[model samples]
Target: MIKTGLYFGSFNPIHVGHMAIANYMVEYTDIDQLWFVVSPQNPLKKKKTLLDDYHRLELVNRAIGDDLRFRASKVEFGLPKPSYTIDTLAYLSEKYPTHQFFILMGSDNLESIHKWKNADVLLANYDIIVYPRPGFNPESAEKYPRVQIANAPLMEISSTFIRDAIKEGKDIRHFLPYRSWDYLQQMNFYKK
Candidate 1:
């Protein structure tokens, strides 16, 4: 059976940190392939200045390129708003019955995961791969036995920080993937 890991995120702009976590998950975990599931909207977050969903998805694709092990998916775009992980997981399970699925997330997300829709079903069915986020510790995963904490290289870069730098006319070359950086510059994205 093919093992696949679903890494769901807003990825308003795909950055090096997001890529690092996805790379580490497949390299270090049992996951054979990692899909960066670009969410249209996160229920927990306030939708104010979110980048266009297609643009965000395109950025993720640019960052991932033709990596056979890594893929970009817009599974939630067809689904309802505040895309629930459980609902997506259920849909995927039925759609791809042959592939085993796992959820890849950051420690920060796990901190408030209990509040998610059908959190109990998600915990009961799928395995979770949690990586450390900047300012967030890994100890929080101890509470969830099904969670696997990854010791991947912790990158401090975040989309928010990258956006801020771009808006402020600061350099962000080092924070995003080279191709993504080039694409962003070519399109003049994130400039205030």
Candidate 2:
């Protein structure tokens, strides 16, 4: 059976750090494919700086382009607004019954997992892979036995930083994938 790991996030713009974690998961874990599930809107976050959902999805596609093992999915776009992980997981479970699903997230998110809708259901149904984020502690996982911490490359890049650089007219050439950077420049994304 195929082992598919769902890396769900706002992915406001697919950055190198995100790719690094996905790459590391496939390399070190049992996940055969890592799908970037671009969320339409995160229930906990204010939509102040989020790019258009399709644009963000396009960025993810540009970042993952041609990588057979990596895929960009707009699964959340088709789901209800303020998308919850539990709903998405349930939907995917029925759609891809042959593949085993795992949730890929950062330790930062793990800290707030209790706030998610049906958080307990998510934990009970699927395995979770949490990666370290700057200023986020992995020790919190000790309290959650079902969560596994991944030893992925530690990068300090964040979409907030990237957006700030763009708004300030600074170069983000190194933060995003080359293709994504080129696409952003060509499309004038995040220039406002």
lDDT values of the candidates?
0.88, 0.89
- Candidate 1 lDDT by residue in tens digits, 77-118: 998877999999988889999899999887888999989998
Q: Which one is best on lDDT? A: 2
Instruction: Give a tens-digit lDDT track for model 2, residues 78-105.
Output: 9889899999988998998898999998
Most TM-score-accurate candidate: 2
* lDDT assessment of candidate 2: 0.89
Indicate the TM-score of model 1. 0.95
Q: Give the C-alpha miss distance for residue 96 in model 2, angstroms.
A: 0.6
Write down the lDDT that model 1 would get: 0.88
Tell me the lDDT of model 1 at 170: 94
Clash pairs (backbone) in predicted model 2: none
How much does candidate 2 score in TM-score?
A: 0.96
